[model samples]
Target: MSRQMEKTPAFLTVVLYVLGFSLLMEWIKPLSQLTETGNFNVFIVFIGMAFFLYAVKAPRWIGIILKGVFILFSIHSLYFGESFFQLTWVIKLCEHVWQNTGLLFSDKLDSLSNEFRSLLFFVLLWLITYLLRYWMLVKRNMLLFFIMTVIYVCILDTFTRYDGSKAIVHSMAIGLILLGILFFQKIKEEGPFLSFPAHWVKWLIPFSIFVSAVLVFGYEMPKSKAILPDPGPFINSILASDRLNGPRGLEGLDMGLRENDTRLGGPFIGDNQVVFEAKVDSDQYWKVETKDTYTGKGWTSEDSKGNSFYTTGEMIWKLEEQGKDTSYGGQKSAFLIYQHPMPYLAYPYGIQSISSGLPNNFVLNDQTEKITPYESDTTHPTIVQYGINYVVPEYQKKELESTTAEGSKNEEDPKYLELPKSLPARVKKLAAQITKGDKNWYDKAVDIESYLQSGQFTYDKKNVAIPGKNQDYVDQFLFITKRGYCDNFSTSMVVLLRAAGVPARWVKGYAPGNYTNSTSDGTRTYQITNNDAHSWPEVWFPKDGWIPFEPTKGFFGQTIVHENVQGSLAEKEQKPLAPIQPKKPLKPQKDLLDNGSNAKIKAPSQSNMQKISSFVKNHKTSMIISVIFFAIVCLFLFLYRKKWMPFILIWLYRKKSGTETFAKAYLLLLKQLDQYGIKRKENQTLREYAVYVDSYFETGTMMMLTKQYEKYLYKGAEDLGDWKEYSELWENLIRKTAG
Candidate 1:
């Protein structure tokens, strides 16, 4: 075979790289919501493609240096901006990195900010483009490229739940087209392999026919329920037994908030895994857990009253004073557990009775009104599949407003009014300030709730920063940030209310999920997912018990039944709080002489170039210094190129330990030779290249290097002693060949 190998045009390589990357981006678009920005991705792809092409032709050392500088600049622009020039920014960046290092494998990943997510996407795209360029241009490994492409496609398919089969088909088509291009390039570069002869075009027709048949057959395949495997007794047995202990609460009679056992943190986005389907009579907040004690950080609940259960044959549990009475407005509903398996049953505000396959040993926490099984029975576990008869309270707002805290003391625990000793005084001050005019506790509560709901604060999910170690969450949220999710708003409102002598406790549960299809029996099913996890404040009234209040904007809490109370309250001569506006300066008095004088006024309008020139003129000295600094830097780089180039290359591309290290060193040597007009042919093996080089230059070093490389690559040798030595040998070869 001829020593010279046919070379693909640089432009053609760039085209293929861009095309492949675009296809891959299309496939991965479904992986994250952040990737939906087509313009951003296109911009990044363009920049990346340009860099890759530039790096391919430029000196390896220069390329590495440029890439480093570019990366630093891009990161600074994206994350720090002008702050990057300040020493404080570096310190803060380090602190942030140190604090969040553990989050890579932690649940806190769910609460990552969109900015951080975007940064992560940027890094991911950078790595992908770098690898593509390396594999296509440097390694020329088509097989590796194919494997990576397939893995990427599989990842997209696995992680993403596409709306329709069309997305899958589209991704598949892209994959096929990309693969075709890859194969075509491979055949052109390395020639046809054994299975496919030089006349591979002859097999194309049959292959196309087979692929079409397979696609048709797959699409036409029956998709009936019968096609699914039956979840027989074995599956049920496994599910019941400890052997198949899936996620806690999935199998049934599990109780207690397993996830919310401690303090709540920053807002988190949740998975769309449907926990249950409930058919309720009214749209209400599904109460799962209630916290009585707020430790400033989070909430904790007191112990249950007692393990009280009826020995009656029927699977029924009843609460005290919560009996079958029309006065309580009793209503029945059923819940079908779709995924989650929790111990506590979800019900409306007042759950009177529960009946289903649930264990009769269900105990009720009177303080929190949360129900939990008395004991765990492995044999007959209580799955979430149960029916509940709950009582919905109907309270007249007028009566609630008039009701004093005299009799409510018996119902309202002192803990509800408890605030952290370190709680900022400004919080209480702000609360008192807001409710200064309100006479009754109900009015005060309404004022506080209204103030929170007013356009004073913003609800932010991803941007909600976690409270510092010693900082109070509510204080920071109210006075400083004024931006947060439900927990922030609700907790702040609760604290403020408590500060204002209004008894309120934090409540945790799920929001009324989206209403799905209705059953044949006229019951509407609501699909409750993990994302429905919510928290609000419950204020205590004399007879109304604990009434839920939604301070979080956009959420509806306990339906405020207004019976002449809302209108009466609105009509009460309560002046609306004037928004704090900036104080304007007093206008200057007009002078009679000025008015009499003919003074012409002209509006100043500057072009873009004029603005630029003005800016430069204002900073002329700084500009001159900057120009001098730039010239100095350019001169320094040119003079010290020999000294710094190799160091930069080694820092950028050196591998610590592996056969790959030697391989990379060899590739660098080849690139150096290419620059010196002694290019290694595409098809030339290491031994052949060594022989050719030794013959051409009368050097024995290439032969020795070739033998070591062969041992490392083919013979599975691990002790490829000190890669620096290989680098030194390559440097020596380049120096000798330069003559």
Candidate 2:
């Protein structure tokens, strides 16, 4: 029957369901991008454990309420958690000591706290389950059991605020001591350990095994070890040009210019300017763009698809005669110093010969650039290209003014023209207004740039979703509400320049200003965050090349209060946009963070020093437990006492021998009555004890029973009856006590 109970489908069903649920979440990760929290995942495990434990013992209400409380906590935590500290209690229990340790838990503390909070909350609930099961459900002596639970306070205090091992040991010692005391109270003249299988006692073994099995399966206990450190930023994966496919598959577009247009920066935020350090043989402009006009967001030289992620590497070669053997591997190549990153895919600048680590499938682009398939996230080794360097040539502001003379007409650039269905009429109207009556496309371009920098607008950072059905977002930015950030400002700039007969294009790149600190490796690194995202307009500078225009208002946000400067165009040009007023609140603030016992951070700090000091001041519970434990063990030896005593003669010499003997006689009387089924549990004099002894015996025979107890226990007769005599006396006493 026990074996059948052990193999019962009820317990196994719970385990299978929990394992199945966890596996389902694990399997769905790749497709759904769903990430599970430690608390959420562990709650499932805890539920199964609680259910199994409850089922084995058949304590329905305790288990159900425990599960219900966990459910309440889980619901409160799941959608409401904003800070990292939120969790259920079971996690708190697992990490109580770990968190107090402080050194290893610093970085991931918030996540740890959250999971721990869940674990501890549930663990407490489970503890309650045990308490309710044992107390109310099992119908034990709840008051005595509660008195026993006082020892667990010592155990709990040590685990959370003191040494974990010490807590377990102290609790163990107290429990063993209590067991010895209880066993003493239970022993009989018939010999104590001979009880037959009652229904209640038979249930204990399987229930104990069930709890041990729950602990052993480990079916994901909220352990402390799963806490992990943050890995670096996410990187995309795409292969190289030497790997048979040109990055973005640009092999078909062999205009030679198509090779240099693939992305080469490290990590990108959508489309932004990613600048790489460039070195070359002589000073030259590293031209990412060799065209006069752009028709779309991307470069329009050739059309080929490319993976957004690819590995990166660089090579240097001497720009000597084309037929010469490169110095790399007996080929006459430039002695380059590459220090960038590996499998060098593409460099922003031109190179000469192969110097360092270069993956295969790379071909020289006009002996100037490295041609490889585009990869978004390749660990492109940092390498030095010693062939050529690029620097913009100095220009006079007045020299380019002649391009926009009065009555001039523009020859439409084919690549610059686009009439996408995506563009709206409001876009054209805004473009027409910005470029009104300018002599040529150049003046119109300059005029629009001036308008964008003006204070006639506001910048709205809160993303305006679906700017009405008929209008594209860019069109709405220019016409509907001239208020927006870079996406709005740049898109307007592009349309106006194109509409006014100027060859224009859009390019995503970095702006000049950034707060950066140098790394230990002497590399300049920027702590670029999500807030640093930006976009702007890039215009062709005719003979000099493309020049960048930051059309977005520079001082869109600032603390100093100021007003927009209005006057003649040139005067306003000299004036910057108004600063934001300090009084005008920019963003909403929330005061949701909690502190103290109400804190969502789960286990608040209960350091050992504090506990030790508090205990030192008065460890009442620990001291009481210590006293109880020691007293019981002492009783074990002190029953005889001389064996455990060091100076027994001294103790015996000072103490009143008769007085001690008399007190012991009373204790023996209480024990005899307890064994004979009549004793004052709390308080009774010898006379009251003799009267109570009459209850379990016949009134006529009660005198004999009392006489026997007094003779053996108080008069020092040493004649307590054996079982045969005691049985006869007990039968007569039962008759008398019936009255």
Candidate 3:
């Protein structure tokens, strides 16, 4: 008898049903897009019916038949039915899976149709439901069921991005179901039959309270740092070799582009896979590497050399020489890499030192401030984690302008100023025209930057035009195609500055992503993703080092703002350039003869909606908190209306009625009647109201109370029935109406 009871515990069956239902609800989201007219309610109903049938002790054969039927129904509804039962539907699905199986390992998994994806999800759901039911009914392992259920809930919470309050409610429901299962297990362990376990109630109440309190107050728990240990050398070797082929098999890793690639033409679409997390005090461009050599086609660093450094548990690569003096404040930043391993490390402009448990074979290029590992060191690499001490330089425009432009010239090689001989003369002419009147190199660079960022140019990621063979890239972009992405804009600025005799290099890295959270140790964490891949021009100042400039319209640049330079320096710079402006805007060159195909170009501006979206993104955390608080308040009012409404009505009535005790009592009675769905309308007289109540209760209590109140209110009669009697009638009426 005991063995039989284990096979079919009622409590276990109920828990299984509830768990399956919850999982089904979760799958509704992924499946909704696949169904016709976006109506997935039929599938939900079918799933609920299956659970209900199983809970009622359906025969094994019947359950098996029903499961097969449901699978067929799902397949038909998602694919074949849409095709009117064509024989080719199954073949099409098979072909799709065969062709796109490779995409599963890349970020292109979303390329599959929603219907096919939903069919796959349906199979997964069916299997999970079967396993869960078998575990409870056949294996009779309650502990295993509990553990698996908890794991499933955790995965759902992590991946689904459900809001806080909804997650809490779901968690609380699961907890209650688990508690019920535990109680049933306890009863089965004892005897055949037993009395209610009244003694356990005392402990259960406090446990429930403790759990509730934790759920409410601990919603924003500190997120655990994503620190998975390296999967050893063999696996890292496979990953390293695989990444060279493409980002096909490495979806989440930073596998899209290499740091020093020689070509940069493609669609600017990004998967936005998060690559790493940084803990810092303020926001700054996290620079990974810089390119000094521009080969007319693309940027490269083929001839660059670096100082090799070996790690002895903690490696430190100083940004400057030991005796060098600087006027910049320093801060510490730590980076935690998540996706694929890369040779370069992201740090701020002026890094002082790096400390990490890194491999002993890495090189630091002081010129570019880039760190890269040896070819052999990255075999089977895991996530790279490190910290850096970096300086945030403060600049004074007067000092930078006064400094000589040739202060620290690398006379041996001036690769930054190198340009292809085939570069169009119009490029240099335009640069000269823009900065003709500038007195200093700083002013010239700024003027060029302002020209690019002005409304005359636009940023386009999708429709970027490529230059024809033997055609200069910057010339085509500047003189012909005025619309392009970050590379086009940044490269243009670099070439223009170099033409103007200012040292500028192309720098590429990620833009700072959403500010996620902060740690108790005062370290703020940010999430950086693949979509944040960006490029900007960095100009060298005499004593200020490399200063980044933003020439792209939609993107914000972190250039140091000079407060004092605007007053005197601006007047001096503007006076000379004022006359250079054309009275009538020159018509843009329509036929550049680069590609021999004319394409209409329009400069895009940041729309008002985009500006508002940017503002919301910057303040997303505060907005989410405010919305959650408002939802909680609304839920509280809705759930406990009975407990609070009476007090609210009384307070409101008292404010209106100063000292009319009888009138106040009548008003409170009307409010109670409204609560019971017996409201008196505006046109109903006191006698009519009493008659309506008498029809339901078959009592004159309402009539008696109404008559006395009307007599006292309308006739100014002080000698009405005792106030105590009227109060008693009001209480009796309320009690009767409630029943």
Candidate 4:
């Protein structure tokens, strides 16, 4: 007789389907590391609800209402700073939708506000959930989703820093189980059998056992080292040359700092190649140029193409004359040794004169503050070395704070305060909030600088986000992705200062390079590498001229302020200031970076263990969630064992035809009956218990099965005629228990 198998319960099937969908959702969680895709938990909550409603057969209108509520709550929580019931977020959302509708009609999709983008994302999630519901319930298949999940994880594992090894394992387990259940369900519905066949379980058991064994072996077995070389370096080498050229081609091939300011915001790798060696009295910021214009994306100067002048003998490159009231205490000289030919000279603040070894005349670009050596008026020269004489000013704090916009040249020029029309309003609002109570421009600038380095922002090099085409760089850095390098910090400070009516310009230069050695005269020679290339903001003060401010965390600039001095004797006794904490070393510890201080240029000497540890730390949240999800899946399987174990037991003893096989299968039957709530009392005899179970199930098959089981136990039977002949009675009782 062909024994029938009971169908898997609808509730169990729904749970499995929901679990499969949940596993696929895990793939999206890693995106938080790369972009401002806030709180992946929101997705999980919504997805779970959607699946639950579908499983319960909830009305379509209820699903629509739930979705609307979720969207509103998401907007209120993520976009607004007030209560959920507040209408401000609703008004803003409506405005964004209307504005974005027009932009969409004009084919300017990238220009949509974040609120509209978030709404679109919510809609996308809704669409995906609907499709998943349709596929798992109506179509009774999830093979396509399974395949897509595997591909998605594999791509992320290969291209991004996301470690998808665990995710791949999860996908395999969930996908196989889901496919197995759906495949069986399809067979139960369409196969020629009038009832569920026990023989199908016979086939299924071996298939499942084989797959589980493969999965266990694959996960637990030792993995062989990859035979292929990593392609990262080869690919990076190809792209490095083009990126080093800067946004504009006019910027010369300087290895350290590029002259490009048109496009900013993205991760960059560090280069340790030494660009120049500077022997200085003390470490100071090596200023290359200052940009005055903010075009929403990057820095530019309105006067970049204005005028040029040629200087021959001792070159004077001062921006403005120092007044008698300004105190210039220390006059220092530094010699620079160039490793390669550079288009411009990098000098310290308060520079008085410059002399180069090259025979080329120096062309001074006033707009860019670039001093380039030329063989003739229009020809280039190879600049090997240069000498600069500068005075490090010790400014009086009282004068600086007291200085107003009365004599400020910056107020007359709008270029220093220029902002793009497309710049987001929130940026200015944030700047105003930061400097609300500050009375003077210097105090406001200081507050803004302090706010950036106040631990709210993170300095990262590898996973920084690049602004989209229509996105404002400063706005993104300030509001969305609050993680970046010196460029992000510096540009934001400049924009904030400008928005607050304090004139500020973006300055790009190298950090006082790493201290290498000291000379006989006590002059320290620092090695400036491509990694030392950095940027900062310079606020224009009437009395102090352009004062540099360090906004980047883990870094401090050499800006010294002195108390007001009345006598000449006290001025003479003002000793030379030592370097303000030497720039951190290029070499890293066992850990690659600590709070990302040396991220400007990191040493490439990370050990294998360090790399593994860093990977674990970066993806710790994902790892924890993966482990919890695995535990939950295991618990679910254990809790529902009765619905699944009968097939395993039947498949196990189907090939055997003896008394021993009969005895073992009969014992399994008793256990299934107890689990199904028809328990066998300790006082009842085997025949009586069987009758009790038969009465509970409203069938006499259990009583007949018990007689065979008792015969197997009492009689010394060498063989049971054919176990298949009596299998129908056992299967009939087991199928009833499954129900």
lDDT winner: 4
Residue-level lDDT tens digits of model 2 in 1-739: 2332343246433443333333223222221111112234455455456646655665668767767665655644553444435454445444554774473356544234433455455666466445533432233223454344444444333222122333333333333333332232233112435244463255446655654565445433554652432111111111112222334333222111122322211111121122233222221222222222322222233322222222223323222221111111111111222221223333222233222222222433331223433223452222223222111122223333435634333343455545455666666777788777766544676688888888876665432322432345555555566676665676567767766556666543223224345545333333222234444555544432334556778633211111232342233233221221222221111222144344232222344443443454365578779899999987897564423232332234334333234334334435544644465643455556666665544353445555665676666544553334443444433322222
Q: Estimate the Cα RMSD of every predicted model relative to the unseen true structure.
A: 25.0, 24.1, 25.3, 16.2
Task: Give lDDT tens digits, candidate 3, residues 387-453.
Answer: 5655565556775665345554533247778887877889889999998977777788889989998
Worst 10 residues of 3 by lDDT: 575-584
For candidate 4, the 10 contiguous residues with the lowest summed lDDT are 579-588
Model 1, position 198: C-alpha lDDT score: 46
Which of 2 and 3 is ahead in lDDT? 3
Q: Higher-lDDT candidate among 1 and 4? A: 4
Per-prediction TM-score: 0.51, 0.32, 0.42, 0.48
Clashing residue pairs found in predicted model 4: 5-196
Model 4, span 1-739: residue lDDT tens:
0011124466755776577566657666666653445556776777777777766767789989987898888767766776777787678778888889999899977477767877887788778887876665556688998999999888766644567888888888888877776776666656457244586678678978977997899799999997865543333322333343334433433234767677776554345666789988899899888888788778777664654655644536443344323566676788787654466788898776665533347766666777777666446554547777777776777777775555445633567777889989999899999999887888898899999998889998656776765789999988998999999999999999988988888898889989989978688999998779999998877655778899999999788877655764335554433422222221223332344544432333545544554566578689889999999999998998888787777777676775566667788888888888887764579899877887787889878877777676667455455577777788777877767
Q: Kindly report which residue stretches of model 3 are placed more than 4 angstroms away from their true locations once superposed.
A: 1-241, 244-256, 304-306, 310-326, 358-361, 366-368, 374-383, 404-412, 561-739
Better of 1 and 3 by TM-score: 1
**For candidate 3, what is the lDDT?**
0.62
**Each candidate's clash count:** 11, 79, 5, 1
Q: How many backbone clashes does candidate 4 have?
A: 1
How far out, in Å, is residue 390 in model 2?
0.7
